[model samples]
Target chain A: MPPTPRRGASAVLLPRLGSLVVLIAGWQAAAWFAGSRLLPGPAAVAAGIGEALVHGEMAMHLSATLARVAAAFALAMAFGTSLGYAMGRSDRFDRVADPWLVLLLNLPALVVIVLAYVWFGLTEAAAVGAVALNKIPNTVVVVREGARALDPGLDEVARAYRFGTWKRLRHVVLPQLGPYLAAAARSGLSLVWKIVLVVELLGRSNGVGFEIGTYFQLFDVRMILAYALAFVVIMLLVETLVLQPVERRAGRWRQRHA
Target chain B: MLELDIRRKEYRGVSSPLLAVRDLKLCLEAGRFGAVLGESGCGKSTALRILAGLDPDYEGEVRRPGEGRLGIVFQEPRLLPWRTVEQNVRLALPQPLEGRDLAPLFASLGLAEHRDRHPGELSLGLARRAALARAFAVEPDLLLLDEPFVSLDPATAGRLRGELADLVARSRATTLMVTHDEEEALALADTVFVLSPRPARLLGEVTLDRPRGARDAGWVAERRREIERLRAG
Candidate 1:
């Protein structure tokens, strides 16, 4: 039998809350020893968060960062899944594209951002494009593994049944690739989140990264912590509420049997 | 009707190319069921793959009814784990089928209650039944089975074999099954083709003149001995 909804929710929620309390207590202790100027207590950072929300442009900057992440995430996933599927399906393509994938995978995200800014001249397209570029190879590598792992037995089944392109793709290919897509989406999102901020810090004038950059210049540890906490909270929510749920649903069939 | 004449097939090994099948010929009259009985690793599957048009690298000629659909039950169930039993069967249909239309087929397979269940939730026996249901739903003119009842318990495999024979007779599809089980070959197939080991060659063919339902355990025992004798010779 399945766990009751309320019990299941608490089973997950209580441990998370416990961890948060422990983390805050440690931070508060550190702050009491180091003093507020060096490292602010949790309450000082909370005040900084409230001040940013009310008097500063926290909402605008946060939205800007999110938009970049969304655009880059979508772009990387779309292109990465297609390329990965192609490479996985064809040996010739995989051999041909392998070196390029290696090169891109090893290239640092910072270098890619700097190159994009230099090449595209500090435009929004360049910033988002660079973030996407940094992420695509990782997505491709992961999704290609998924495509490669597809059962040849299922392929024969599809052919024996004479399934047309669309039917075979929907019922056979896509379902097999679902887990890979989820894996790419999860890792791709996290990668994009980190790189988008770097792109903003280096080239773009408006975003959470730029705000963080400004706070870093003034050495306002509280505000930096505030912005960092807010973004971490958003990412945590996305992981728990969005990515985890999707991963669970994609593999729900396995769970029922297990 | 279905016909296969494979002159040669070779696989490239690390050291040298290996021959898999040579001069293998088989023909099944329309609506007739045939079985190819061979030892394991004797390229029975290679020949089946050639017939199924999955191994085009081989030198062969396969003839079937023009525009006729084909259905195959592989060694494994091979059902999409994410799809329900009904949905997997529906996906095999050339045209859409209503739930009510599929209910009887499900009931016939003793899968009426499992229509909404995913393949992962099924026992090995039930999953094989689902695979059989999917094959029949396509209304195929040519049916291929590759050790379809393999790896199941003896009792489960026996029952499924009986059900499969009945279904194939009802559908009247020209079926070619590859198996090592003498009992299965004798029980279901109208003609059984015995094959030699490696670079597979046809040893001999046995035709069961008796109707499938009328074949008794004694007849099967006699036939198994005859097949063994032929294989040895």
Candidate 2:
């Protein structure tokens, strides 16, 4: 109802840049008052990351964490999408499966990770399984909503024209589902990576999360910040480079038409 | 060739089971145009759906061409908005329409230039025509149009009707269209089957002996009066 000013790249960039500057300044001020060993500022953390990359084994830990995140993401998305679609399309299936879905969704991430380790006895499978189990419920809930919103009219058209399984899914079903899948992937990737960190910290011995846990025991905040920052940067890269492109491509039609 | 004999079709309702169609018999020989005429929500679409084989729960025996060669134009275009016009039509036939030229079909429907564009970019009339193109592209032995031109402006609907009439006549496909408009039924179909309200049964049949697209306003009015008199009796 009210006038909103026109926005360009600068409109978005300026506010975000301003906020980051303020955040960094506040962190630097806190580091100045606190001892550098306990509360390292941005420069010391950046130097710590450089030393780890050059002298220590940061890449191996980073790769391990990335691999775990990828595996858990793939597992969750594949299983969740199929389950969600089934639940969405059939009321009977949703009625039967909804309580389990609700229970899984509400179950704490920490509990799943701990139980998985307890049951599987501290292996790679347990770590990946725990992260996937935690992420699957969210993916199912999001994708089920996508499925429920599917166009029945198009479905009839597909049926009346006798679209074969492959052809119908590729052209009709998938195109309609693109946005939803993209949304699920974006959110699911973030959630899976976070849970992967928790899984790694709790069980695995060679990931960014494990490095952070080890540094925490020795009270080396600089190294802890270094590994966490490196991991966060890698995740940001994955989000921007991989997932954002997919989400953009998925929603390209709507933006172009709108 | 097509044949439909739906003894009864019912839908579950909140309070009671709602009857849709019963004792509705229809037959169309090869290269004929048939229409089911009824009031809005008078189980016309249910009958068409049964004929389309989308509604199999009905107690009926429907005989039509094999499923693969059937084409349907729903009330809405139902075009995948993400796909281009040409892709939508091309997808119906996995193998290309063997030795068939769709250039003329596209030209006749005025979709030639818009073939590479999405449905979202087109007007409703154009979208409907695109739907017609998709159906006709299959070179179907049987074509179904469910209230295809109902929601258009008179000019758009009229133009689309002419395009459809021309397309269907050229193809000589056994076409069955359902509509509430008697004018549309008379304009398109050779034999029109009038259906009664809920639990719709065939009330009567009016065979328009005149050739399609040749039955002008005057002839239509004359036949309409006769049909009205028949209904009154």
Candidate 3:
């Protein structure tokens, strides 16, 4: 059954606390039964996380990974949105580039990462390039479809009235394309982070992914589990703090009008 | 002035052209309001589209005396959902229409309170009013409307038609509209052309020489008789 309506702050916190307790209990019981080699208990992983945080290993790696993801995400958004608009508006662009775009969309992230490393070298550029490449094609496909679906008669009206290019784009085109762009950004962010983590693990000597690899090599199960959990926590933070807020703001306009 | 002769259009894979307004000739003088009245699928919309320069696929001899700009309103409001009502009107303006100037336009249509609101927030009638404002704001040489009031209730449609007639009279824009309603065609147009269905052809023209305000029951009865004759043929 769905929980009853929570009327107070404490009522809201109750479920979260209950879920946490259940998770810790289950992990502790499993660790005691299996021993530490295969599955580190909650206490062991917490200790590893604490040790890494105090020594600055966790902070350094976390910041490096976050910075890379952030840069790649920004580049992806810039390229994808512009390219999507062009592809949507021009039949010539669609004819020439659509097949290539579809191929890129279907290409595996690993293959793109490998190709980028080979072409650009195993540097910061390569990692970011890999993530950006993986992200851009999907964004282009989604946003281009959005652009193509705009009403032709409305566009004709704009043209007949001699609306300047900027005015036409801003007032007529951008608003219609907002939701599609938002959806693409949301999905692109998730995919880029995951792909960036994998790319870091495969080659980079830094980042959360590299730290997890290091822990694996040393057979430190608790440290590996700690890094994985930390990454999950970061993903949740981004979803709640960044993406969800934008989604809600964009949707607010739609709701108010609808 | 605008003219079209022998316009023909067809989509692929059919036995014949979907629209063949053959030997169709129109000589619309500047600043006159004309209406095309016909049943559904009678190619009235196709003619309007050709005038608006949207359907370039048609073969036709077209002539316009000057750089005549046209603002076309389709059946739907077609306002960008993301834009506020003010922004939608602004789309029709060549430059940013000043807020003070826009206020009276909005007030005239009973939409002053909704200027900042998005199109999706508006009722169907209000949305149509915004669309009309968008068209009027353009200050076009010619305005083409394809059944712009088809979806509205009779009272609202009547009110909008009256408002539009006044706007056209005031602006002096050459207007060509397509509608199936005999009352609407007769009420708003200076000249209404009745058309036959399928291979659509012009039946005859009813010249409403009386000014818009003079339209009453007798005027409507005369138009009904004229439409009945066309339908019977």
- lDDT of each candidate versus the true structure: 0.88, 0.87, 0.81
Per-residue lDDT for A88 in model 3? 92
lDDT per residue for candidate 1 within B1-233, as digits (tens), equals 68888899899899999999988988778889999999999999999988888888988798975456788888889999988998889878876443438777788888999999998889999999999999888777888899998999999999988889878878968899999988889989999999999899888889898998789889988888889888898
Name the docking class for model 3: medium
Best by DockQ: 1
What DockQ does every candidate get?
Answer: 0.71, 0.70, 0.58
Judge the docking of candidate 2 as incorrect, acceptable, medium or high.
medium
TM-score of each: 0.93, 0.94, 0.87
Q: What tens digits encode model 2's per-residue C-alpha lDDT throughout B34-97? A: 9888888999899888887787798879888544268888888889888889888887764656
- Segments of candidate 2 deviating more than 4 angstroms: A1-12, B66-68, B96-101
Using DockQ as the yardstick, the better of models 2 and 3 is: 2
lDDT (10s digit) by residue, model 1, range A66-141: 8999999999999998999999999999999999999999999999999989988999999999999999999999
Q: Candidate 3 residues A38-116, lDDT tens each?
A: 6988988888888889985898898888899899999998899899989999999988999999899899999999998
Best by lDDT: 1
Clashing pairs in 1: none
